[model samples]
Target: MAIQPDSAPSELAVAEALKALGPPGLLTGCRRIRGGDEQFLLPAERDSMATRDRKARAASGAGRRIVHELLRRLRCEDVAVLRGPLGSPMWPPGIVGSIAHDEELAVAAVAMRSPSVRSVGVDVEPMLPLPPDLRAVVITSHDRLGNLDQGIGGRLLFAAKEAVYKASFPLDGRMLEFDDISVDLKSGEAATSSGRRLLVRCTARPRILALAYTP
Candidate 1:
């Protein structure tokens, strides 16, 4: 069972926005975080998250709940998504997936193993402008925003880079600096310092969400 959001815009709205960006063979799920979500964590999951405070566990538990449900749909139920190398999620064999959350939302994206797709990543952010000071740390000259509204572009760019980082790490096993990659919103792609290329997609409805995956 999935955790339901306490209020609108509905959780279905968030899931639809994410699903619209996914390609064939990709599965996505989402839900609003609720109080006591941390109770959903399995023993191993809770052990792995031992150091996290209550709020972090709640967010992670919500994300894991979605991950488990997505895996079940993929015919790989009862799987544990542990924090693995570089602190990225380690999925069951033959799966490439990602999970992310903002203060109020959690999302998961999963896809069966495929020669054409190597890794996947997803990120969500509140539908608000990115703070100006932080923009300098995230936006680089190599990045392109296309024609997105200036107000939302900066925040979207931030989310895109985050998604790309999560997707890039599993393949290269390298942590990335924000400048280590460049995003092109018009074409919906990103290029990492390690030469990994990812397809990126974004949606502002319900909330701001970004997904990145190998093509």
Candidate 2:
């Protein structure tokens, strides 16, 4: 079942999109983009809030709350997620997950507790083109998968890279530039030029949602 936020009609659409992309064990949460309203942080999480600007505070708090809610459902409790040096959410021992939001939406995915799954990542972005200069900076020769659908190329690549970054960081820990990964739209996979691959499932309608997972 989808975890729906209060009074947000668009969340229904977001939930449907999530269902299409999220695998069986993925836990999801959705809310209208807002700031400073989440109230579920534990003491340590509260202390870490000192550094975030309002927008960051709200989004991170909401994302963590979603993660905690999922954890509680699995009978895990009292664990507080913190941000690591690379800015990814730090899950409790033996847990792995990802979080993402834009100015209008917030969603998170947590892998149900298990030993085999290595990492999980989920990102949400509006279906809009990157600005021209940003487009130049984010697109690279490797990402130009020939004959990929041109209409959604820019937006698709950007979302794919983000999902790849979130999915890979738990293990790689290196900050990756957009060029560090190349995406093959035809195969629905993103790969490092050196060949590390993450399976990417993207929903391009209504919005863009990408979920990446590694074994």
Candidate 3:
């Protein structure tokens, strides 16, 4: 939920905003982390996250709940969504999606297999500015935020890069670092050193949400 004791109102608001921001043909959902989301995990999903701390598992479950729900929309019902190598979710066959969460919120997006859209990634962050200390590491020289919301520009860039990494890694197993990707906020695009390019869209409303997709 936005990380407050009484955040349900804004939590829902964030969810709606994220749904609206989703890329075309991508199903998106959000969850307010209630700290009991682990209870929603299935046996196989639970086993995959067994080694995580209580809070991590709960958060992971929250994300998976949205993932599962989205998958169902695509007719991929009851998939386990296991945590595979490098911590990425092993999505069901004929589908590609990504899930991410902030402290009190979880968001996911799913899309059916198609030649036009190979993979998708979605990330959420509380509507807060990225810490100044970490700016040096997160912002690349090629990145631009001109005319974008300056208040949370750094935070938005961070989310965009993270989304790009998630979307690109599946296309090629190439690992990426912060500087390995460049986000052009003004153009609503991102590129990775591994030669993958994605259209990135973001909104800073009840939260900072970013989605990256290859089409």
Candidate 4:
């Protein structure tokens, strides 16, 4: 069943859920884009024991509604959203988009008329320390030894790479590794091995965040 905006969880619960996801810095400046006139109703109740399930469900539903509204605003009819073979969300015949959700937060980015916009992906992880081994999986040898310098910055780098991979998958139709992209921690930007630019920017302090729309 779809989730409904009317069922939105409390702000406190949403905040707590985002915190549990880690990387609080990512939440900085995250804004919700409304779907304007195209909002739709989603089922409010679902089976779940998680403390933040309701909040997360509500946020995801709101995100989906906003995407539909945005498409409508852009005069994009013929909208069809489906799951790709790899389970990535797919959009209508002439539209392209990406949707992401973590705990109580959900975000979506849609582009009209052409696949020329290529890839657009967003991810948000709470601000918290990560296990060394998992951290290693996210940062490349060069990044660990170079600009990233192995710390909180390294974690953000990892998150940025994850977002990049999410944004790029639809364009290339393949899975990508952290090493497949070069990220400049100082610059907050990522580029494909082939020099395709992927811009990543963070907002807020002690950040609760959103990373989106990689080129």
Cα lDDT tens digits, model 1, 1-215, are 22234356668788878888877788888878888888877787777665568888899998888888778888897877887645688888899999999998888888897866688889999999888898889889999988876568989999999999988887888889989999998899899988889999988777899999897
Off by over 4 Å in 2: 50-52, 113-116, 144-151
> Clash pairs of candidate 1?
none
Per-residue alpha-carbon lDDT of model 3 for 44-142, expressed as tens digits? 988876476888888988887777777777777788999886888898777898999989888888888687679988888877878877678888688
The best-first sequence of candidates by TM-score reads 1, 3, 2, 4
Say which prediction, candidate 1 or candidate 3, comes out ahead on TM-score: 1
lDDT ranking of the models: 1, 3, 2, 4
Task: List TM-score per model, in order.
Answer: 0.93, 0.88, 0.92, 0.63
**Model 3 misplaced regions, further than 4 Å:** 1-7, 148-151
Better of 1 and 4 by lDDT: 1
- Best candidate according to TM-score: 1
Clashes (N, CA, C under 3 Å) per candidate: 0, 0, 1, 17
Better of 2 and 4 by lDDT: 2
Error at 190, model 1, angstroms: 0.6
lDDT of 2 by residue, 1-215 (tens): 56766676787788678767766766777766566645656778867655647777777777776777777866678788877665778887777788898887878787664544577778888887666777787788776545655446677778878988888887777678888988776577787654667787787776888877775
Q: Number of clashing pairs, model 4?
A: 17
User: What's the lDDT for residue 153 in model 3?
Assistant: 94
CA lDDT of each prediction against the hidden true structure: 0.85, 0.74, 0.82, 0.52
Q: Which residue segments of model 1 deviate by more than 4 Å?
A: 1-9
The per-prediction CA RMSD against the true structure, in angstroms, equals 2.2, 2.3, 3.5, 8.5
Q: Give the TM-score of candidate 4.
A: 0.63
